[model samples]
Target: MEDRRALATLPPLRGRVQQDAPLAPFTWFRVGGPAEWLVRPADVDDLLLLLRDLPESVPLSIIGAASNLIIRDGGVRGVVVRLGGKAFGEVSVDGDGIIAGAAALDAVVAEHAAATGLAGLEFLCGIPGAIGGAVAMNAGAYGSEVKDVLDWAEVATPAGVIRMAAQDFAFAYRKAVLPARGVVTRARFHARPGDAAAISTRMAEIRAAREATQPVRARTGGSTFKNPPGAKAWALVDAAGCRGLVRGGAQVSEKHTNFLLNLGGATAADIEGLGEEMRARVLATSGVSLEWEIKRIGEVTP
Candidate 1:
């Protein structure tokens, strides 16, 4: 049983809080058990204060849109912080720069930038995650990545709120080397100007390309694993004879081998088990290890 003593003393929050909330409602996969305490912060200040005041023993996990996440079936203990409403979904454009709140969707950012004739963020149109997630994972598509245009990002740390320059967060393929204690709140990106018609055309082309190749419409996380140097993970998986492979109700996507699809009634364990099986098979056949791109959180049911 969760103790409500700590929460009772804190002043009322601008956001909503629910005890024993079902997490599946917030995730794209529509799977997962309940969160012990689910809190949606109204803004950056709300989030920081909540984090600062919460007891050290109470665990906290920050989630953006749950686009690349899998919360296990046994459920997450302690608190789950999700940024909500306009406080964390603002997007603004100034001159050659774009400012986005952490909870803003990547597709919305892309559209906003493209409307202003910004060229670089067109790649974001193909990504289906929040700005914070894009920052955390260095999400990318086509030939561009978030790191390429990122000027700076604002993050809340255990110490305090800090503005971190792009260099401060060392970035690599689909990963950021921020201090493990940091959590992003917002980001600023700079892009070159382009013809409005051309930008729109490019975004449409990218969207079409993704639809043609990926299971974009399905209830699934984007990619399962990153491609190793000079090799594609999907090809390795396909070569391992795992294409259209099934484990319980989860299956390797027929459209894209790197994608794993939940064919209704699938559990997180089933999905993760299939992913592990694919990795093991691929390693055995290709002599190379695959790294999971999808972030897994919470405990597995025993």
Candidate 2:
């Protein structure tokens, strides 16, 4: 097969590489098919080598945390790179700045910053996913966004790694114009000295609020759709009577209409189908089309 030949042509790597690696376990929903190739680079050098020499015919996809994502059942083609290990998960602080590897979970970064008496990043405790995905999507919660504090981010492209300033990202609500095929490796966020007690209190409040309102324990992907301008996505879903709606084994979370859950035996199709139905219902009732906040990838089953 072409995939096998493409694998053969890859330059030697220090990282782990696999053909037909199961991707379901890597995601929160616990569904979807295997990836054509799953690669975990040992370090930045190893990642650079793979990126610089990968065949042009093959496609490359980057995933992080797999928290707010849905990989379709037909699986992903070409290469899927998942950054991990201490090299990509380290979080440290220097003076008024915090440096976090792209693989670092947003909550871990928030904790690290708070431990060092740094404020302004406590909002990260409320956002799911890793720093890389957060930066790529301009993720935000509790009235703050990544763009509000990010100083700069380093991204790796086939050409080479480049350090881009926050302004260079041209961040918009829940989106950024990151370079095509560029993978975020790390980011620096601006912080300021604040009362440690105050920061900790803020984070705790966020955690409590999330637990009360969201389906934190279910097999679910966080927030199914983006909030339309001047309107809330969850309210629209509830208004359309989509709360607890079901398709196959997937159901809309009764606790939070914005979340879609896989009740043990759901397929990727079932979850995605339920989301489409929710959108249709909302559009029909509210005349506002919902945009997906969760990233969905790979081919649908034929």
Candidate 3:
């Protein structure tokens, strides 16, 4: 209701637009409230046109796989656009390089690369988020980050689409510096020729490591906080004795202190509050202050 005029104008949209759509179902944590307006564009052109034609007053936000995300209980205001289906889900091979749509899952891209004998991207198999969010935050695992292999990414901004190079991302630790509200649509990565069998074996090992170290079965956001400089975040959290700490229905994953889980019937506020408490506890135990890696959006209920 905050942007009523803008919402009313969406009926003519080429894509599906729903009012008060349930957002919790889209997320890994299975929490949060509704999306005031959820936009599902038909394709890249539809999305670009929608972004161009829409009023500037109506705030727009983008989401992908919903992994590593927490939408607050009050719900998101303005418009929430998610790229999905065949339109944004394609990953194509180009010689030793590959182009992945933003909506494409990291696992799928990894598999594609493996099948195509593309090495240097096996690490992406461990990341749970889609390529869009992965490029946005430079998501990675297994000693290889996105910045290391990403040649360029195509992003849609308020002004227009731009092909952003690796240097333009200004990536560091676990963050990327891009224009405000610029959404990634596609990414290009360069890989070397390798044996498909070897690539598959590496991906299998990554899967095993993830299963052993992370709470893959829990309703949780992956990696609650970024590891501070030289220290592992989980180590600090463990030292603080905050492992298995609980708040409301949410609890720190005992399997990995870096992950926070919603143990059924948990509120978004509960998860966020638990994260803050863990942060404080870790700070109290160690001098290092852990920065949140998970993206929290939307508002709290009034």
Best candidate, TM-score? 2
Residue-by-residue lDDT tens digits, candidate 2, 1-302: 88679779778899899989999999999999988999999998888898888877888989999999999999999899999947799998977989999999999999999999999999999988999999999999989999999999999988889999999999998999888788999999999999999999999999999999999999998989999999999999999999899999999999999999999999999999999999999999989999999999999999
TM per candidate comes to 0.96, 0.98, 0.97
> Candidate 2 — which residues are off by over 4 angstroms?
none
TM-score-sorted candidate list, best first: 2, 3, 1
For candidate 1, lDDT tens digit of each residue in 8-95? 6666777888888999878878788888889988777777778677766677787889988898998888888888747888999978
Worst 10 residues of 2 by lDDT: 1-10
Off by over 4 Å in 3: none
Q: In order, what lDDT does every prediction score?
A: 0.87, 0.94, 0.90
Residue 73 displacement in candidate 2 (angstroms): 0.8
Candidate that beats the other on TM-score, 2 or 3, i.e. the better one: 2
Error of 1 at 23 (Å): 0.9
